[model samples]
Target: MLDHDTAPTGDKTIETAEDLSSIAFGFMASKALFAGLHVDLFSALADGPKTAEDLAKAIGVPLNRIVMLTTALASVGLLTIGDDKKIENSPAAQNFLSKQSKYDFGDYLRYQIDQQMYPFLLQLNAVMKDDLSEDAIASYKHWMTDEEQASVYSESQHAGSLGPGRTLARKVDLAKATSLLDVGGGTGAMTISLCKEYPELHATIIDFPNVAEIGWRFISEAGLVDRVRYIPGNAVEVQWPGNQDAILMSYLMSGVPGDDVEGLLRKAYEALAPGGRLMVHDFMVEEDRRGPALAALWQLQHMAFTPEARSLSVGWLTEAGRKIGFAIDDVDALIPAMTKLVVFSKPA
Candidate 1:
């Protein structure tokens, strides 16, 4: 199974079977990961390593389940079991997934499993039916409303704990970045970070009306009302608000599928002033599909919805952006995180 997981495209039959296996066990893997995250297993291990028996007692999981979790984590390269049966985070885990790590993904996983996945599971049939159930509608509205804004803001801000956004944000000369556009910047996490970095930078945040109300309050509380404008509208039909020196695209593309993804990027490209950059931040896969367990698992989540829209490769993105006349530059794996940042620029 390990060999098969690492295999590239040599055997078509094996490749097809592996692909199916990945999809088949994808849910199981996701549940295991979320379970580990929920119980603070990674954080406990972060202080140092321990035996699964020790960990089981520490986290209060049964010994059987701890063994199962360890086996699954080891298979995914997120944990290592020594000869004496002590367990520790693999380098990947130490860097990106441990709750104590500065670049931790615990909050992001919590958001997905607790908020999005749980609710999405309940509304799956409705979503498939082209239906919007009243429960889902009410949950969404309530989530975005003023009363729950703090929870929304906390979740959104910490949700990027797994993002590659910080690296992309650093590579650019923000001094020249006067006007920026953050389309669908949930609760203004990315927006606030950029605003703080570039004193001259002003930003427009576009999100759902109720969500934008939360964002407005946040930008105001941060004393950035003068620098950030909240614009409430549907990202799908809204015209691209122009004159941005750079467009922040942090973790914003995966939820959009196929043509909509392309359309959104096209709009963003056109919205940029000449020489402006589109800072794409996401769990980008490697050129050759192999294990970067979190990213591979994330690809499954992407595929769960639209078959055509899986976690994309930065290499593929480069080629695609080139076709659109943008120059792809400074692609890098954001350390201490799961994703990669690929900065694409339109010529001056």
Candidate 2:
């Protein structure tokens, strides 16, 4: 009975049942996409269109089931039906989902979401209730203790980071920076990007030993062995090398225990020379703590592993940095709406 003037402000109303249904049924769509990636469906269709029967044979599914699978994918716009009624990948699927494409991120999606985050997300209710057992909580450090698990996680993370690293490199100006420190730098993605941009830059990455091993492979492949090196230790516990021109901490803040946040900031502060820039790129909730759904969900995901993980806000981080003698330089988006890069500079 409420008209526009009588409606509650800032309250969402269900205009149609479809909106609620879409939200409820969202998981099925995600699972369908994951199922497609599992069988390398996009890669099979990379060359051209194929008959459903051919896809069945290629993906080892029967014709009936293959049709159903393709139907699900097509409904989600990841696949399409041709004029000839053959199945094919859509433009987006062909570009980033196909294995033949250099921009392929299928493995990162499969490994991180399907294998890791999906499992943790199931425990979100338990996390919210604060009833998760100590044994049940598996932090990143615990996973790093197992070599195979660490390698699998780090490899996919490295793949995921490369594009963002390139994006960050484009966004931030590091033309004058020579010595750079990348704290908790997974596989040296940020370092590689920065070094590639500034040829005169030499960088050091600090991360877990297992992660450092994987990082070396990536650095070596990039052919920057001479300019980049890894200092293998926990970034919070290690003796960080000093007098850096810039320090980049991408995706580190939200992953650490709540108590360590300020200490880590202080460490970065002390480690930098006067006028050095410290860049923090992570998922930060809005100052009002309202829902920017993806960033909030990512912060919740961190709690699945690190139970003591704290949600960050730009206001809080800026205030914290100011308390440590850092002046705010800039705040900008790193991953569109999901992540932000906050730059702070130590006064000369």
Which prediction has the highest lDDT against the true structure?
2
Task: Encode model 2's per-residue lDDT on 1-348: one tens digit a residue.
Answer: 111121122246568889999988998998889989988999999999999988889879889878988999999899999888799999999988899998888888888788888888877788778887666755777767778877878888887888889988997888988999999998998899899999999999999999999889999999999999999988889999999999999999898898999998999999999989999999977765664567888999999888888998777998999999999988877786678888999999
Question: What are the RMSDs of all candidates, in order?
Answer: 6.6, 5.0
Error of 2 at 256 (Å): 0.9
Give lDDT for model 1: 0.69
RMSD of 2: 5.0
**Which is the leading candidate under TM-score?**
2
Candidate 1 residue-wise lDDT, 263-335, digit = tens: 7778888999998988777776666776465676565554444344546777677677888888876676664
State the local distance difference test value for candidate 2.
0.87
Segments of candidate 2 deviating more than 4 angstroms: 1-17
TM-score of 2: 0.92
**What TM-score, over all chains together, does every model reach?**
0.66, 0.92
